[model samples]
Every structure is written in structure tokens, then in C-alpha cells.
Target: MADLLHSVYVADKGLIFKVSGYSQNLHLVVDLVTREMRAASGRVDRHMFEAVREVRARSYHNVLLKPHKLSQDVRMNVLIEPYISVRDKVSLIQNITLEELQDFTDRFLDKLYLQILMQGNIAWTDAIKISENVLKNIKWEGLPEAESPVIKVHQLPLGDRKLRVMSLNPASTNSIVTNYYQGEVATVNDTATLEVLMMLMEEPVFDVLRTKEQLGYSVFNLVRYTFGVNGFTITVNTQRDKFTVSHVDRRVESFLKKFSKDMNRLSDKGLAAVKQSLIQLKHTTDYELKEEANRNWREITSCEYKFQRLLIEAEAIDKVKMSDIRKWVADHFAVGNKSRFRKLSIQVVGHLPNSADNATQGESGVQDHSLQLLHAGQPSTNIQENQEEFITSIDDFKKSLPLVNTPRVELAQC
Candidate 1:
């Protein structure tokens, strides 16, 4: 049983059941899984407490990582996903009985919208046979296509907002600051522009933030699409001993200000070179069948169904003008354009004597084109008490902000 059962895991999106063995043992593995799913015995096992402790430890470690902690906060507050924090999980699990667990599992499995992906040397007919056996054993009602649950992300409000939370690891001296620039509704063209911008900013950002400025060892950027609503983020993991979270946040803004200027100096030939490189990257061949299958499965899961996204994006990149990139930066990031842009800043401040500075004191820094370049990352060491700009209550802040109503992806007509 141990050899045949690979693992069972759960994430924010969904649960996954995995098994592995020889092709001859495939039926046996499926049968074992089906029986387990069908049996909902409301019997408590004392031995399972050890496993619970392990899970709790892992969750604790996950939240301890500043970046992961910041991401969880953003999803819960900005995206409005009801995520269970590590502390909450511990309390909930302690009070939960086996009967409650069994009831919850039964209710969860009562109706299902199953998505299966089969790879390797399995034939189509054999795959269908395996799927049928599992479905028959489960004996669950399939959810209607229209009624299937879709992941929804709340639209961030226009203008700048900041969420500053103390870091989970009190012993650790490192802090993380992430500034997310939310774009308009998701489109292939806009996504392509973001990809190009991030790529261009990648080397320069590392050079300026980590190498030259010495902010932190880990400084990077990401292109994020929450439930297909486009956005991008720039993050810095700096130590509170050297600088406060407020200072790091300001420096991040300062980098964007400098990067914006660099974009204007960019010539047509330079932009073309970057575009061509991106095109070549898109056309790169998959190393194996698994890679291709995983790519397609991602599309299926997201409901994007854009299997040829890479090629489509490549074409869009070819059409992208230097003006498009410049305008995108200016529209979303330029100072004095607060009414037009929507920005969310998440700061996970570490526990240290110097780390307790006001997270929202540097609103004026965004407009300052020239500052002490050497000492700019260092905010006044004097700890401020008042921080009205910081989002103290997430619920109150979100009450007035409008949600982004992104249109659903329609299935292609046959």
C-alpha cells in the first residue's frame, strides 16, 4: 500500500490524489483509492495527531517566509479568498472531531466537477476505462458546467493603498516589501506588454536594487494574473537592521521612477531586439511530452483554454510599439497619476528595534525626482507614531472600493 500510494495534497485551489506503480498494478492502485474515498467511517484515530502536528509545522514554516506571508495576506484581503492562516488552522484542527471531518468530506464529495489528466504511454480507451471505474466507485453527481465554481479576484481600488503587517517570525530580522501595480482587465496584448517590461526590468532591477544599492540578497519582480485579472509586482526582501520597511518601500518606488526614465531613452532598435528575444523564447520547443501536457492542463484548470498562448503572445509582442510600453509604465506607475492607477503595497515588517518606523510616512517620496541617492533608502530612524495612510482595517478599506468585473472566458463553439 505504501509503495502504490504516492501522496495526497491540498492547496488553495483544490485537492489532488496521486498514485504510482507499474501499468499492471494500475487497476489495484485505482481500486485502493476508490475504496478509501467511498469509506467515510466516522472513527477517530489517535495516531493521526502526529501527522496533524507535522502539517502544522510545515504551515508555520510557510508563513514564516516573508514573501509567502505577504502573498497570503494579499489573497485574503485584495483577492478576498477566505484563507486559513497557520494560527487559525491550529485552533480549528484542535477542536475538529473525526465525525466533523467525515461529515465535511462527505458533503465535499457529494457533488463534483472532475478534471483528469492522463500522461505516459496509456492509450485513450484504457484511460477512459480507468476514469469510469473511479467515477462509478465514487457514485457522485457531476456538477453542471454553468454551476461550476470559478475563482474570482476582487478588483483593487484606484490610487495607492498599503497593508503593513508584522512578520510572523519574531526571531528573524528580514522584512519583505511588495508593490503590486494592478492593470486593466486581462488581455493577451496587455499581458504581452507586461511580460516584455518585466523581462527588460529583470536585469536592471537586480543590478540596481541588490548589487548597487545592496537592499537585500533576494530582490525580484513578478507578472501576476489573479483569476485572469492582470497585474505585476516588484518585491524586495531587506533586513530591518539596515533599513526600515518604510525605507525599502520608498526605494522600490524610487527604482520604478528611475526605470520609467530609462524607458523613454530606449530606442526603436533596442525595443526590437528585446521583442525578438521574447519571440524566440516563446517558440522554444518543449523538452518532453510531460512539459506539453502540463502546459495544456494549466489552461484547462484556469479555464483560459488558450493552449496557443505562447504563439499568440509572440504575435502580440511583434505588434507592441515602444509607445505602448512607455504608456503602460506611465499610466500605472507615474507620480501624479494616482487617480488613474491602482496600487497595493504589502509590507511584512520584521521584529527589530529599528524596524518599527511608519510604513506610510513616505507618500511624498514618490514625487521627489531628486533625493539623497546614497541615503534615500534610509528613512528617518525616528519612529513615528501616527500612520493614517496604513490600512489598519482591511474590511473598512474594501467597503468603498469597486470590484473588477472581468468577463468570463467563453468556451469555443464547435
Candidate 2:
């Protein structure tokens, strides 16, 4: 009796097929996977209904209500993979029948570019045999490597940018403000510098925004790597009852100002200490095989394939001087530096008292009435008409910008 755990997932680029269990079950798993991949049958309606409900449920999730995911969705769909819908349409899902689903699978399986990442106790010959067995039954024309799509992000035009969306959950009072400072496409050195910068600012950011100013209980910074574009985000989770989204946004700006000064005043010794701290972090041992495998998977999926990324980054971190940090700040994060500075501020406004005059009182008021204006191409109260700073329509704004193709990393770099 051969039994194995298996999963199929859709990613930004392609579908991933995974299976794990005893080595003895490898052939059995492959046979099962190939059979499933060739076609889909039975209970299609039930699966579609579940998927629709899943999407609906996700819309109301607390995490989705925050600016982190909201901003990410815009960045991915509008600025990155413009062709892909950030959210699947429930209407489309409802209309998709068993025949359509099967047809889609047939079309999908017709062309292929399979990337296998085999690990664990499996023998090399067994891995190769398993891969061969999986592919033998599936009729596919090998896709040219050049024809494979490379994920690209639209280069944001210089100046301040903003996208303000009313939270979908009207009863929720949790508003979020995220200030993202876009960096370059990034080299190994650039990646190292930004990581170090985040490490240094992480604690201070939380302290200044949440602890000192009492903006909100949750405040932190993140190094965002969308496809291959590198950037950083400073986020504050505040309630509408305590503070307005704009107030929190301003406080984040203030924190950045103070942080810039702090960075400049940072002594050479202090900078070295920060670098050393980051180096130590990179050197930290992977506690499990999964940890190591996941790290490799990230590089593989990102098309960077830098298995020695930690070691390379550690070296780069040591080389990053105070001047390099200052240059990075001026180029990306500085308020006055508008030429190369790309900043996008995304605000998710939650239910508030008098945030807008038309806002209804009580839990019933949780409706996203402003979304009507969004669909109508009318600027909401938060955005002014003809304001270049505010992104009235994500599609239009993205269309105005040029997409930059991220260069794939060669194995030589590894």
C-alpha cells in the first residue's frame, strides 16, 4: 500500500506540484499525479462553490483589510503582473462549469516548462525516474526557455503617489497606513544594503511610531521584494477611533525624517555593529531541512538561483559603509530627493466617526460606498481631482508608466 501527501498550487508564474512520503511510494505518487494532471472529473460544482466562498471570506479577513496585502495586490497586479487579476471574479467562477475546467486543463497541459526541485532521502536515479514517469503520460510540447514569461514591475514615476481605498469591512475600526519607498531593481550589494537598513530601522521604527508617538500598537518596517524589484515599507496599524489614516501617514513621514537624521548621526562604530548584527543573522544555522529547502525554493522560484545568497549577502553587508547607507537613503527614502525617489502610500480607511460626512453610524455603516466612486472614475473625498499625487485609477496610472524587465540572474553569479 503506497500512500503519499500531495498538493497542487498556483503561483505567479506557474503551477507547482508537490508530493512527499516514503521513498517506496514515489512511483505511486507519480502515477497518481500524471493521471490527475491529464484531466479533471466529478464534483466540479462543489469545488467552484468552495472557491467562491473562499474568496468572499478572504475579502473580510483582518489581514486582507490591512494596507500590507492591499498595497501588495495593487503593486502586483497594477505595477507588476498587469495581465493577471489580483482577485478572481466570483461571477466568472460561478459560470465556470466542469467542461470549461476540463478544457482549461487540456489547454494548460498542452505546453510545458516543468521545474522539479527534488530533495530528502530520494536517490538521484529514483528522482529522475519519477520525473520521467510523471511526464511520459502527459502530451506536451516543450516550451522554449526564451518564450517563458519574466515577471516585471512598472517603474513608478518620480514624486509622491497614493492609493486610498475604504476598507471592505465597514464594522471594523482598524485602519492601516503603509508608506513604501521603492528602491532599484537591485544588485547583490543593493539587496544587502536594504536588508541591513531594515534591520537597523526595524526597532527604531516600532519605537518611534508605536511606542513614542502612540500611533498604534502595531508598527514595523518590511523589505518588500516584488518579483525582483526591491523596496521597503513602513506600516502602522491604527484604529479610526484613535487616529485618522492621514494622521498616521504623517506620523510615519515624521518617523522617516527623524530616522534619516539618526542614520546620518550614526557613528562608524554603530554602523559596523549594525552590519555585524545582520551578518550574524545571515550566518544563523538552518534548524531543519525544510528551512534550507524553503530558502533554495525561494531563490529557484524567483529565478535568482543563488544557493549561496546568505554567504554572498554576508560579505556584501560587511562592505556596506555609512556612505553607502546614506546614498541609498538619499536615492530612495529621502523626502527631498524627487528625481529617483518612488514612494507609494496606500491607506485602508476603516469605519470612523465623521471621517466623511456621508458616513453612516453603527455597524450597518460598514458598507464600502466609496467603491462606487472608484468604479465610476470619480475621485473619492480622500483624493482631489487632477491631483497627480493620488492614484485615482490603478489601471490608468500603471498605463502611464513604463515596465522594466528584471534581468534573470546567471548561474555564474551564484
Candidate 3:
């Protein structure tokens, strides 16, 4: 029932460790959690793998303990690390027959060879061959057969002795899908997003809150994403101004519609460029063998392997029209009130209101409180901060500056 598992793992039943096995050529870091375990980095080997193996083997729940550092005996010091209880040592027990242990260890060492090939300091074509071999050798029971293009490759080509490749398949709607299967939502928060933000600020949230009700500038209109979860997320920060509870709802609804309509006007070239850039990113990073291994394992256990076909599908993406993108945005990305969303949090940075019509909402029609807060908070503020603040009239400001701080050259008006 845990989300991620950060405990240690052993293929040969703790006899062989897969850490530092790669030396400096590769590094594999694993942070196992409940229900899910994450192992990443380059390749690792026996000695370093032993260290990681020990840390995980000696953990109490999630806290790792170094077995060697426990006590002086090295023998007696085995299980005395901090936060470790003797009862927690029960997981270390192994009941396999020596034959079973030997076979498991053989499998571990065999896979370690493949690990070098897949995660080794090697070439892409060579690594691909190694990956195919790794898959062939590390067959666990009930694992579905891997088809052609069994891997979705993410590669980074550097013109050096060490070439790199990174790939993940996202087949599951959950675990290892991005690594083992295909599907992700790439949002465009570029100039277009900024333009949208500016337009949405049309009825500046401040007016809606202070003029009608009151709120702070904690007002936000974002096109965000849930960390590794698929989908686009929009968040509205409502601290700057306090709005009538109903007005907040209505404004959010209105803003979404306008955003969608604008998206409908996006140039085809722009959309295509963004999509292409995302797709091209598939080739930017190199793959480490451990990632490939865990990703495959996760897919076999938690996702589907067919996700390897993502890149091709993505490359063959349909030429999207402005209307199509707009509809897609509205369907998947818009921020209207829905079951997936809620008023996440409403934080008022300045003085907050205790009343339901929150004291922060201010007198029904109070002048801009920010301006008021400004004057009230600092009576001796600087004049440069003002947009139209000047001792002289516009004409006088232009002429009089000659005496104050005139430019040396005959400055041309921009």
C-alpha cells in the first residue's frame, strides 16, 4: 500500500550487490519505498552493491542502517545500527536450499554480464544488443514475452568514447509506463501561456476582490502539471484579493472559456514546433542500464510493455488544427471546477480577514488596499516607484531634467 519502495534489493539473495559495479563508468542509485521501489543511475557492481544491499537489508521500515559501522566486531557489529531493532532482522532470514541459492547467484552473475552490456560504458547499437540479451537472460516466471522495439529509447549522442542512451516505456496507466509504455501530457506554457495569463488578468482579480469583495495578489492562473502523474493542471492563487465566494467560482469558469478560445487561435507552426521539441527530447538523455532494468521489471510487474511504441506514434502525430488543440486543451487541461480539482488552498499573505465576508474583503467599496497598505506601511517611500510621480508637469519634466541629469551625447528618442 506504500507509494514508493526505497528498501534494498538483491538478485542473488544478498550474495552479490549491483552498486559501484560500474566503477566511475556508471552509477546506480536506488531508493525503494512501500509498494514501489526506485533504482536508477548507471551500472553498479559487487562491492558497492554490497554496501547498498547492506543498507537496505538493515533498514527498519524506511530508515537505512550501515551494518559495518554498527559495532567493533564487524561480526558482532552486523545488526546494531541506529533505529534498528533485533526484530527487524527477521527479513534477513533466508530459507532457500543451497542449490536454489547457487542457482539464484548464478542468475545474478549472468545478469551482471548483461548489466555491463546494457549499462556498460558502450555504444548504442552494442547496448541495444546487450539489452536484448539482458531481457533474454533475466526471465522471471509469468513475464510476458518482449516484442520487437521492446525498448523506447532515450539516447544522448556525445562525440566521445562514452556514448549514452536513456529510454523508458510507459504502458501502465501507473507504474513504469513512461519507461515501459507510452503516453504523457506536454503542456505549452510559452509566450502563448504568458499571453493567456495577461489576458486572464483582464478583470484583475484584485478588482473582483477589493472593489466587490477583497483579496490579495496571491491570485494566480497557472497551467501546471501534477509531478509524475499524467495530465495538465491549472491553479488559481486567491490571496491577493478576497472575492465573494460565488464570484470566485464564476470567475474561474469565465477564465477557462477565454483561455480555451485563445488556444483555438494558436498558429499551426507554433503548436507543431512545441510538439516537435518535446518529441526530439527523447534523444537528449542517455540510458543507464539499471533504469532500463527496473523499468522493465516495473513494467512486467506494474505496467505493460507495448509502451515501447510511443516514440513512433508520437512522431506520426496528426497535424493538429488550432481548433483541435483548443478542444484538447479544454478537454484535458482547462481549470474549470471539476471532481479532480478543488479550492486547493487560499492563503492571504497580508493581514487576513476573520469574518466570512472576510475582514480582508475590506469596506464594500474601499480604495485599492495595496496602495493604502503601501502608504500606511511606509509613509516615507521613494518617489521613483510611482508610474506618474514627478514634481513637474510632463512638459516641464522633459525640459527641466536638462539641469538635473542630462545625457552627455545628443540622445535620440527611441
Candidate 4:
């Protein structure tokens, strides 16, 4: 809601729309505008016009002067959308003096910049000035004619590619890797595209690279669930010892080059297997009850992706052709992975596999003395799936354990 309000707020002036009739919602809406909240929504009130003008002169707008690329402008795709009539609005519950409005607007813009735009790559100070200038100078021209996005990957030759995942969306994390991977063109957005892309990698990446070859402990193929709560990420966790981050990176590149699916689509047998695997993973064997609770918690906490895992039938993905997968990867996974954080952080105590040399203690700098191993190539962590799994607490362990009744309330949050 806050994001929508911000987009609307930054789009131009204050929003103005009339409902068939609104009763108690008017005051509530006005309160939000006055606060200058992000993506906030409210009813249009008499004072909102003045507020918009005030914000224009005061708060920074995130107007993109050259937004053609983001909106698929190259393909000549233009979006003309209708205004939605909102029933809710912000209310000015606190006594905000008019004298404070201008300063508040400036503060509001500052908060917005800090909250969203500063990706740690850029300094806050620099972003502030840039945002201010961009907002102030924007011509506010009408929406541009949408066109096809630049097909950067489509131009790649067979030899030039490394690894690729199909269409990546900025809204997702895997899209980030998909782009950073080989030259595969990624066609990503919403659910359909993301699902197809994920299905293609789901087994091959896991069985071949992670399980068989032992690439990274965390290296398991993943299908993204973007429908409910937009999601995308496929992590490969390994210690630093086995492969320099660079070596794994290169291997993935090589793997992508050879793993082409231009001819054969997912076979019915493949689809059925994938479907069965998915079903197996979905139902928590009564023993995996904590898993169920954890899922429920996520669903309750975030409105997105709660029912999504249950909703999508994985069998639907079997129809995706190998060509589609290749093209998608080629497009989205071709570039831009330097953006992620690699703090080289080490928590002194975490889940180190029992196989680790426990006798060894952290030296002045463990980066050297401590071995770093990738999950795939390294020996198993000596973990037993049958053993008591780690949950938030023993209570959670019972929640996940196969049983008829909930665990006694002896233990609390851990």
C-alpha cells in the first residue's frame, strides 16, 4: 500500500479520484498524505491538492526520466491503465502544524531514499542529491510507448556463453543469479515464466552438480514461487576451502555452456518424476511437523506465497521446451552478480558439520587455518536426516515430529 502511494505520489501531483460516495474514509486518507508515507493510500481530500504541490517543491520524487527500458519501451509496448477507486485513506491523527509540513516533506523524501534506493553500493548523501535533482528536473512527459526490451542475450553466440537462467525479474533474487550466470536469455516475470525456468533447472542442477558432483552444500536446484509472495533465489553454499568462489563460478559457467536443451523438451516421464518428487517434498511426513508450523508462520506473517506452494501443480511445467529454458537463461543470467553482498562473514559458532575438525580452534584469522569446502565436493557434514532436526526450539521440534498431539509447553522461543 505504501509503495503504491509512493508511486502515485511521485508520479506527479496529489491523487484525485471520486468514489460513488465515501463516508468515514475521507479523514483517514488525508492523514496518510500529510505523513508522506511510502506507497500509502488514502481518500482524496480538499487539502490534498495543496499537499501535492507542497510535496512537489519539498519531497524528492523518483521519477525516471528515461523509463522506456524498464517498461519494455523498445518493444513498443505501452501501458494505459485505469485508475482504481480506493475506499481507504490516511488520516491526520496527530496535530501536524502547517509550519511543519515543508520540513516533514523533506524528511519524508529522505526516509524514502534511505529505505529503498540506497543499496549499500552508493552513499546516502550521493543518492539524496541525485534523487532530488532527478525529481526536480523530470519533464513529467506522458508514459512512453513501450517496446521490446533490448535483447542483449539473443545476440550471444554459442561459444561466448557461460551459464544462463531464463527471464529474470528485478523483483526476484534468482533473477539476479540467472542474469549473472551464462548468456542464457531469461524470460522472467509473474509465475508462468518463472515456473518454467525453475522446472528446467530443478533436477539437473541438483542431481548432477550438487548431489552427484557435489558442487555446494547449498547447491540444490530450486523452482521459484512468485505467485503468492514474489520469490526467487537458488543458493549454493560451500566452505571457502573446496573451491575459491571464483572456481565454482567458472565451473557453473562451463556447466551452462554444455547444458543446452534446444532439442528435447521435458519428457512425460521426466514430468511425472518431477511431479512425484514435488509431492513427496510437499507433504510433511508426520515427523516433519515443525516444517508445517514454520510454513504456517510464514504464511501468516507474509500474505504472499502462503497457499502458493499448494496451488501450483508442478506437472504443468513439464510442457516447457528445452529451447525455452535455454533462451530464458541466456537472457536474464548473462550479467550483474557483483551486486550481492559477500561480507566474508563468519559466525564463530553455527552449524558446522560434525566432520569438521573440532579440535581446531579459531586462530587469529580462521580464513587461513580453517578449511573452506563446498557442499558438493566436500564430504558430507555427517548430518543424519533421521536425527532430531534443529527447529526454533524443542517445542518446534515436537511440532514437526510425527505425533498425535502437540508438544507440551515446557520450552518456549529459543
* Error of model 3, residue 239, in angstroms: 3.9
Q: Give the 10-residue window scoring lowest on summed lDDT in candidate 2.
A: 369-378
Model 1 error, position 216 (Å): 1.1
- Greater lDDT among 3 and 4 belongs to 4
**In model 1, which regions exceed 4 Å deviation?**
1-5, 18-28, 40-44, 65-71, 74-76, 82-87, 144-147, 336-339, 353-388, 410-414
Report the C-alpha lDDT of model 1 over 268-334, residue by residue, as the tens digit: 9988999999999999999987578778778877767888888999999999888889888878884
lDDT of 3: 0.30
RMSD in Å for all candidates:
7.8, 4.2, 25.3, 21.9
TM-score of each: 0.84, 0.86, 0.31, 0.31
lDDT value, candidate 2, whole model: 0.73
Residue-wise C-alpha lDDT for candidate 2, range 10-101, written one tens digit per residue: 88788987777777876787687787677544335767756755665445444444545655655555567545543444224445555766
lDDT of 4 by residue, 183-226 (tens): 21222233434455565566667776578767556564444331
For model 4, give the 10-residue run with minimal summed lDDT: 79-88
Checking candidate 1 for backbone clashes, the offending pairs are none
Which candidate would rank higher by lDDT, 1 or 3? Answer: 1
Q: What is the C-alpha local distance difference test score of each model?
A: 0.72, 0.73, 0.30, 0.33
The superposed Cα distance between candidate 1 and the true structure at residue 154, in angstroms, equals 1.8
Top lDDT model: 2
Please write out the lDDT profile of model 3 over residues 1-414, one tens digit for every residue.
223222345431122223334432222222111112112222344456566555644343122111111111111111112122322342442232334444554444442222222334656775555445434444423322332112111111111010001111111011000000101322222223322333333344445433444332334333332221222222233321233222343454454566556566657776666656545653344466565555444433222332353354344343434554444454333242222221211111222234232233234421221111121112122222322221112123223322112122111321
